[model samples]
Target: MDLEVVEGLVTAIRPAANPTDDGAVLLPGLVDLHTHLREPGGEAQETLITGGAAAAAGGFTDVFAMANTEPVTDSVERVEWLRAHAPGDGAARIHPVAAITVGLDGDALTAMEALASAGVTLFSDDGRCVDRADLMREALHRAHRTGTVIAQHAQLADLAGNGQINAGRAARATGLPPWPASAEAAIIARDAVLAAETGGSLHVCHVSTAASVDVIRWAKSRGWPVTAEVTPHHLILTDASADSADPVNKVNPPLRGQDDVRSLRRALVDGTIDAIATDHAPHTRQSKQRPWIDAPFGMTGLETALGVVVRALLEEDALDWQLLARVMSTRPAQIGRLGPASGRLPQTGAVADFVLVEERSPVRVDPSRHLSRSKNSPFGGLELPCRVLRTVVGGRVAFEA
Candidate 1:
């Protein structure tokens, strides 16, 4: 398959003679509303080029980059630098999500209006919660006024103190600190109320607990402007899998219990959970190799996102492709305010971005083949039903097989 791009827009998709050689399905390009392109500092873990490649390989054409890097992205200058420095790889388009507060410090706020004028539609302090209710409310007010989104990491630091794993059996068995669901739920509940009252756009990042889902549902029922995302890892894995204390499973908002997993699935199916973000955190092996407690929390996710989703939701007959497109593409585009139809079919004579998913053959994941600098992927050795045959972003062949 060949995709032609001109001026960064897909001009034409020249098809292979046998386009459906392996029963490939053309999907609207996937959009990840949450991804960590660890650049400017964590180059050993990931860079713009490598992270973009990973997103292309995973069938994503657009990704909302989290602002948790060194010299956190909080200003228009940093945001402009990211936009101009995006690698010319024709891979996923990187949308900078600036931090909501200065340095993510939770005290002073960033120039939200100025950043929005610079074309940043989303703001977040994803690795930390805005613990101060007043600050959070002010940010929400600014967001409502600017029509932008404030994505929260949603963990109450005081409640989740020094926790290394979920507060279930896995925590007990590992003898590690417990990360209770209350820690995440409490923040979601507070933010939901703030969003409703202030009429601001609130996006909950990586909904890992059932309580979080319940709160989001209630917010929706109340007709509040709240949207939530669930990570591919959290939707499938459980805290039970964390018993080994393998740092690969260590993530913020920690993998949850079985009920949470089930609830997340149901929420996704029912539209209570809006998008399936990869939360594609890339951490170097030397760092991930540390004892679970001391290791930085993250895992490489871009390469394995689609396969995991297919195996967990599609293969299990829990969701169909249309709904999958909404969760992975359409809704994310809407929530992130990333102009219309990112993962949907481009109208004829319009520029396009999309992916061809080969579903007839199965393939096992291999961590060594990851394009990211980090090899901390959790899907290693697992065989799944689908592979991305190609990804065309803006009519260019970003990745092909």
Candidate 2:
């Protein structure tokens, strides 16, 4: 096969001849629809350079950087700046999602047309819910006109206030206010209606509740343009882990119960959930080493997502390779509107963005070894039976293990 690099772009085509028949599974490089790069601010925790490197190492060729940064990406200038300033050497391509509201305050809407022209394909008020119904409707309407997707964080501020974990026996046992599942389901249901009414694409981010999955399923049955994602933590871990007071288990849309995890896995297998996004929120060690209540809500996920999927879903044959490709790469690329130029698949003319996996290789998760600046994964030390051996972006090997 001939691999060529032109003007910093990599392209991979048919090789001359096969020397070794090493059975390596070739899949499209993963695309994370939701990630917190923390650049343009919050650099102490993570910067574009470090986060992009981590993404490449995790086998991702493209990542949608959420706009909830220090300065908040809301304007055309800021969006352009982010796109131009992305780390070019990283394994993954970085696409910036502009905030739906100015400063993500949920007060005034941003310039949808200008941001879209600046290459912002997704808009979100993440890290906080857009509580104003009228404002949300307006944002959806604008997004529809611009052909951009609005990704909701799906948390009800009132119900999720100071919520430490999922609302269940686990939270009750810990004396922490529960983050009721209804808090997420309600927003998803409402947003589905808004999306249907406005004919806009609405994507629910980090969906953690069984009821939320049901809502998305119902919406799809009606042909509403709505999609949802499930995080690896939610699929594998439960609020029961929070009983240990380990900050690593803490996250927004907090780790749910075993029942919820089962339901999420079922949804993933049945195509009820559209994709698996990392929501890769990184925090410094000092930030996560505090009391559970005081600790930040997030965990670094890029490097461990595939292994988690293999362990939780593949080993049981719950999801096959095709389904994994859809959830991890195809669906996310479609949702983000990141065309083939940004690494969708490994077609002849397509950008050579793909990952090589040693399907039988065993993996031991190690936070310290992660490429991300933060080491806050709950899955650290957990062994899985597969590993991402190499990640190629534009036909260039961005990362190799």
In terms of lDDT, the best-performing candidate is 1
What does candidate 1 score on TM? Answer: 0.95
Clashes of 1: 2
* TM-scores, each model vs. reference: 0.95, 0.94
Please provide, for model 2 over 60-147, each residue's C-alpha lDDT reduced to its tens digit, 9 standing for 90 to 100: 8889999998789999888888878897753578888899889988899998988888778899988989989899898889888989
- The TM-score obtained by model 2 is 0.94
Ten-residue segment with the worst summed lDDT in candidate 1?
1-10
In candidate 2, residue 84 scores what lDDT?
A: 83
